[model samples]
Target: MGWIKNAKAATLGEDARKAWDAGSPVFTPILNMPSSNAGLSGRVEDWEHMMAAVLAIGWRLHTWAVCSDSRGRPQAQPLFVRP
Candidate 1:
């Protein structure tokens, strides 16, 4: 088997982190950075990059029960993390 956990525990980009940090309206997805941020062109390609970061850090697309503030959204979720 492969180390899915280890693989997912890799580096997450900064933008995705920033977007995620902004937080959602409790149940919605949160991603905002205007149409000027490097990959904020409102295109699918940009979203792909964001998704990569979320997955790399082991967050489910729309299932992970993780919560984060906008200031530090990319910080790892506590589920797969160790104490």
Candidate 2:
């Protein structure tokens, strides 16, 4: 029982780390060159990196039902729970 609990906690931590690292490719270029990252001087490679990250996370988002106001703050609405 103790080993099973520790394994479950470790798995959760690993999954969280993967999600965080997955966003870095999208953010790194923008962080290094915020002024140049927008339309005036956007790089195709950086956009591709961002798109890849977006695609990976897009599916995860479908698990939740999100409604946003004009300010874009997500209004939390319950989706479903698995037994």
Instruction: Tell me, by lDDT, which candidate is best.
Output: 1
* Alpha carbon RMSD to native, model 2: 15.0
Q: Report the lDDT tens digits of candidate 2 across residue range 19-77.
A: 55665322111112122333344353433333344344332322434355455443333
Clash count, predicted structure 1: 2
Model 1 CA deviation exceeding 4 Å by range: 1-29, 33-43, 63-83
Task: Provide the lDDT at 74 for model 2.
Answer: 34
Q: Count the backbone clashes (under 3 Å) in each candidate.
A: 2, 0
Name the TM-score of candidate 1: 0.30
Local error of candidate 2 at residue 37 (angstroms)? 50
Overall lDDT per candidate, in order of appearance: 0.38, 0.35
Task: List the candidates' TM-scores in order.
Answer: 0.30, 0.29
